[model samples]
Target chain A: MSDVRLSNGSPTLERTDPRLPEHPKPSACKSLFGPVDHEELKKDFNAHLRELEEAAAARWDFDFANDQPLANGRLQWELVEHSSVPDFYSRPPRENGVCSGNNNVDHNGNHHCDGMAQSEETSRADSQMECTEQSSGPRKRSACHDPSAQSKRSHTSPEEVSCPNLSHSAEHTPRKTRRLSALQCVQ
Target chain B: MEDQLLCCEVDSIRRAYQDVNLLNDRVLHTMLKAEENYLPSPNYFKCVQREIVPKMRKILATWMLEVCEEQKCEEEVFPLAMNYLDRFLSVEATRKTRLQLLGATCMFLASKMKETVPLTAEKLCIYTDNSVQPGELLQMELLVLNKLKWDLASVTPHDFIEHFLSKLKICPSTKQILRKHAQTFVALCATDVNFIASPPSMVAAGSVVAAVQGLYLKSQDVSLSSQNLTNFLSQVIRSDPDCLRSCQEQIESLLESSLRQAQQHGGPAESKRVDEEVDLSCTPTDVRDINI
Candidate 1:
């Protein structure tokens, strides 16, 4: 029976709108409060993202910013075949380019761009815009940007980690990022 | 291989058909247990937020609901977004000016979690009159994800409504109409601040009972009577009968007050249209009154 469609249509939402179903759909386009100060918002968001990355780094003991496993991290990073884990953890990036940059995180920590990385690069432009605009204080590049680690850490770029997607590696991000977290502490 | 794509259904928005496999007691019990983990702290304004007050939340919620309706978003997106908003506010002390930004970001995240074709950041910015930029929304979306620990699969009142309806013996048409009414009540509950921290299953039960009362549907079974159904649903959600009844009363009062308020602010024809929509009751005065 059609009963199984259960809350599938727009009828009920229309009923509950408190607007009379007509009258030009209420042009609720005006700002609810006032304009947000982009400067303060940018600063505050940068701090929050940095704090989250640090907290995750401490919790997991992996240098998420450098894409390198800490010597003392509680869990080991290993590389498993893509077929080993559920596809939920290894599916290719979706159209949104959410975790597209993390495809740089491969088995050998190599800096080379495979076909998948180039294809997914389209979505990372959103992240790039986010990075350049929000970094109020100079960007945090303690190890990744240090020229000393440049050759060895060529696998991860400062821009990729700064793109607000770093938190993806720490927790519930696109599954392909599981590669970055993949227990490959093969260093 | 390419022709197989043509054989599949394509639509602007995608939705999975309801799996009857999940409509069993096992799933219902699991949902009841999971709802508690996702509830917001009831007194976050007093204990956590220095600038945000409950009244402001009501305004934000009203705006979010309107946007969802305008976009024809899935029924679950608005409430799920509100859940994210409340959970974030519960732990963080946000400035009053940024509240709408937070609200918009919550919608952005929730729409992605629930919709096949989610709302765009640019459209959401336009909805806000461009007060908050898309970049800000994206940054806030990430902060919200971190604060909420990436748990977007929240159990909403919509989830519980399906399981409740499944146990009823009514025909598909009656079930369909009643589901619509219950869903309206659930959305109404989401907009009001009082229902904060109410377990989703209880809210769903109260809403189902209230819908049963408003429609005054008839069935041969003894349990469909308003009081019996309330008791039955309360048991199903594992709550006290008195608590469920009181919740039902709260929902009724909320509806009455919102309708009166809508009439005050809305046009004269507005109330009339609302009356025409609730057409199932036997008597206009009896059902339209909104009080038993």
Candidate 2:
């Protein structure tokens, strides 16, 4: 086992096998890249070698299992934790008026608040129409056409914008026949 | 004293072999995801309308190989550097003038990852004949790190060599020879772009099969026939035999062509002249335009 030699004679591996071949002198192939100042390269290489030695020595004292710096004051390992969502998602929503209540954020921070608000408004209209049948549909239809409806639409636009059938029910039902006709129309 | 040292070495090797399962799990988890993270687009250089053709890449790889050989870098460094180069090229439309600088920077980064003693920025800059500054190399290093998403733990064919080799029932001497040949084959694969599509494990298995077959051919040994070696490698690497066979064939063809080219070049001196001529022809005009 001791007599075995690797062809290139890697230093670290050679340390384990004393019988490995002697390190070849730096060869002329070094010139292949270009005219390198050998003295400067040797200096740089030696500095790098010392740094590696220090790092290796530090590694021996470092505690990998606990991932903590040991008494030697060396970093054992660096752990990088990646977030599934982008940075913006992890941040608190902006306090601006445009996206005030829209907290349902996708990974990219696109708000789902508009959809939520629409659904809530539609349910509100449904209950309102159930309470006062005759006046609600006509008022809602008028609201859809009214310029002021834009502001009110945030709260009531589901009936005005989405449910056009409510308008038809209001026109068809007589005041006395409102409840029965409304139910029939809904069915 | 020698016997005692040998005993300790054997014990360490045994312990390492015992921990292979843990090592494999960690390597698979990190490397597979890292592979997914930074794949080079197949035709990005062309899509970007860049002047970097396959011929230029081949020349660059050859130069990188020379640097690694001269420096006596680990087997993993050159391939890993090439991975960085390809991934960076896929994402960034690099100027032709900066290609060698990019190569040097990739080598620097890969050495940091794989070698005990990494090549310093100063040395790398010197390798470029001061055409690139150390500051510039450091900047490019950061750019590469960002583009790779800071995931440097790549799984090259070298990673799978030991696992594949351990499964073979050959004698110790034959195993060592096979490992050397397999290493050479892996380095050869890194120099060509065609092998880029193959997964690292497939490349490893293929190279081992090719190495064994190569050795067997030289010796005219019936035991090293393609069929037996293919079955053995596929079983060891836990890949489909068909895929492994195809990859092995590709490697064999690569080896043949490279050998033919080496012969055609006549010798190293002539080939060096050809490389220098290519470098001189490409750099001056490109560098001037980039500067302006």
Candidate 3:
């Protein structure tokens, strides 16, 4: 109901704040993650990464084991990188910004068409560069900021977003039935 | 623990059992044939729901116990009917013989796939007051499946409602209240066939609005504008005042009926359970069998 505006000034509200979740980098573990030793955190993270790699190799084996404590290691990292981890991880930053009185913007902002466009462009560029970035495996293709790269299609026109400056070119049009598989996350 | 693993395996096993495509195609063909044999009703397939089957129990007997039987069941049946209608219209010409029968058969097939224990054709016929013959039901079922060309991996509002409700950390009472509203939405769906084509998300939002409307109707203070419905659909489907009003009436009547039945059959303890309090913690927890 609140008529807050997106940074792009479009009239649709964003689902969540785009800022990434604060998963403390291993080296910076103590302050944000709370009292965790740096060495221990690094060791745990390395172990987690190893498990993820093992799981990746055995992806066929890990069906939805609803009752069991399945690692969800990939989903965990995907969520973290996507900033979809619970609010606890990101609540502090919002608290710090609460004094600005702009926090009310969270519930009621127009959709971010420009940011979506920018993010899409960045992701498409990343997709193009992905072949060369194979050495980094999964880490280098940071999806922390733009979750929609996989399916945030350019179905709408620039005119729809009121992007008058850009030319409406055929090449930029998103393919109608672009196949999106989970494995595309590697890109 | 083994049960959980079995449930996981059940998803894949259940996938194969889901022969809705075949079922839908067969049902549609039967419907077309039926229409060819009779005069078409103004309400199209919905006449099956309203006239052919006077009561919800007739269409869905014991299966109504679980969920999405009548109120939740209406929208479910509509889209299914639409899918059949769409396929039939695209391929074959329209007729008036047994269109309502066609719609009912699709609902019967869909209800079986949607619910675990589907009522038998005999039971369904018994419920419909012996108006439809067993052979006719079977014939329609096969025809609907054929018309659909066996492609029936359609979504339902129940699926979307489950997803959205899980995300919300509202109280159990609120959840029940929300579900009641959703029932209204399903009923409203009966008034119009177009809503059957809507995606699951739109249905969820519509159901939420319907629930809000139900609350408003009860409390007499809260009011919602047509703009809310417009915002929900993003102006996709214009709200039909008559249809919305009719759907609301059906939902209220259905709920009242359920309450009456529960009171008569569900002993004091069962009734108390209906009134029991559940926690409203906002934490995400797994709910079983979300698909409908």
DockQ of every candidate structure = 0.18, 0.02, 0.01
> What's the candidate order when arranged by decreasing TM-score?
1, 2, 3
User: Can you write out model 2's per-residue Cα lDDT over B1-292, one digit (the tens) per residue?
Assistant: 9888877656432111123463354554455455555456667657752768877777778878766665667777888898888888887776676777789889988877765346667666656656666655664564566556556767777777766666666776667667766777888888888875567777888988887766654244544678877876676555678988999899888877765565566576666523423332233234334334
What is the TM-score of chain A, computed separately for every candidate?
A: 0.43, 0.18, 0.19
- Candidate 1 Cα errors over 4 Å, as ranges: A1-26, A68-172, A175-183, B1-14, B218-222, B267-292
Model number with the top lDDT: 1
CAPRI quality of model 2: incorrect
- Name the lDDT value of residue B259 in candidate 2: 59
Candidate 3: global Cα-lDDT? 0.35
Candidate 2 per-residue C-alpha lDDT over A1-187 given as tens digits, one digit per residue, 9 for 90 to 100: 3433222222222122222123322332232223334355445434533443344334333222221223433111121111422233123333432211222422111123554443344344345444433322322121011111113223223333232234442332221112112121110
Please write out the lDDT profile of model 3 over residues B1-292, one tens digit for every residue. 7777666544421222222343343443343344322222334344343222223222222222122222223234444444454444344332333443444565566655543333345444443444455545554554455445444545444444543444344555656556644633543443333443443445445665556554443243222443444353333223454444444454445445545554564575544322211111110111111210
DockQ of 2: 0.02
Models sorted by lDDT, best on top: 1, 2, 3
Task: Return the lDDT, model 2, position A137.
Answer: 33
The residue-level lDDT of candidate 1 at B108 comes to 85
lDDT minimum window of 10 residues, candidate 3 chain B:
B276-285
Give residue B48's error in model 3 in angstroms. 19
Candidate scoring better on DockQ of 2 and 3 = 2
